[model samples]
Target: SQQGEEDPQALSIQEGENATMNCSYKTSINNLQWYRQNSGRGLVHLILIRSNEREKHSGRLRVTLDTSKKSSSLLITASRAADTASYFCATDLLQGAQKLVFGQGTRLTINP
Candidate 1:
């Protein structure tokens, strides 16, 4: 798979705690995207970082990319119970093939 791996396969946190996860890839990429998915539902686009960008932020979400290390991280600040979801990182590595591959994902749970 073009996507490498994500650490701490599972996470359990309190509603007010922060959650962070890391993603690594094996191949070069034009862009990397982070997504959130609730149980039995579709994925929600959280943020996107291009090859040139090193960091991005949206609301309480923060994303960082380190091309030199071929790695990325996602941080969700001031987490809420509603923020509990499975987070994934995706990238299209086929060049002209136009296919996006996803990592296995980090399951995050926020307790009240």
Candidate 2:
């Protein structure tokens, strides 16, 4: 499994602040996706940006892709305490079964 690894295993920030997380993968991918998990609940897809795309944004979330570096970064602007959660990056390999391999994730905490 060509899974990615996220840095800064944990992070804490004040409400309304911005949070950034990085992800690095071991293999080429067809696309990359970001997901948010609230506590022990199921993960919810946050964004999906293809290999051909450089960057993407949704609401306060921004994602950047760099195939050359085999890495990606997710940024959350104006984060709220409600946004406190674990963030993971999954890579969809172009070949093989096209399954998603997830990273260890960054545990984010927003202090109110």
Candidate 3:
């Protein structure tokens, strides 16, 4: 499948701790994007990295991509209760017509 699959389907961590999630894809991609969705809400774009980039960071969020292995990881540092949400990874295939394939997503919970 061209869609990416996220690992550790669910994660729970204390406030101020860090949370990490992983995604693996089956086909070549032009770019990868990470998104967050609060309960009963639309998705919020977190970050995007191209196939040429190995790592990227935005605020407390860090993302790393390894094209060789068709894998990517997202790390949220010093997490807060507000960070509780479902995270999804979407990949834009290299040969597709600007389509994105999203994974099942990872459910993250932050405890105070």
lDDT of each: 0.89, 0.93, 0.96
Candidate 3 lDDT for residue 62: 100
Give per-residue CA lDDT, model 2, range 4-105, as digits (tens).
898779999999999999999988899999999999799999999999999999999999999999999999999999999999999998774947999999
For all predicted structures, in order, the TM-scores are 0.94, 0.95, 0.97
With a 3 Å backbone cut-off (N, CA, C), the pairs that clash in candidate 1 are none
**Model 2 vs truth, CA RMSD:** 1.1
Write one digit per residue (lDDT tens) for candidate 3, span 15-69.
9999999999998999999999999999999999999999999999999999999
Candidate topping lDDT: 3
Please give the lDDT score for candidate 1: 0.89
* Maximum-TM-score candidate: 3
Indicate the TM-score of model 2.
0.95
lDDT of 3 at 7: 91
RMSD of each: 1.3, 1.1, 0.9
Candidate 3, residue 46: Cα displacement in angstroms equals 0.5
- The ten-residue window of minimal lDDT in model 1 covers 92-101
Better of 1 and 3 by TM-score: 3
Error of 2 at 105 (Å): 0.8
TM-score for candidate 1, please give it: 0.94
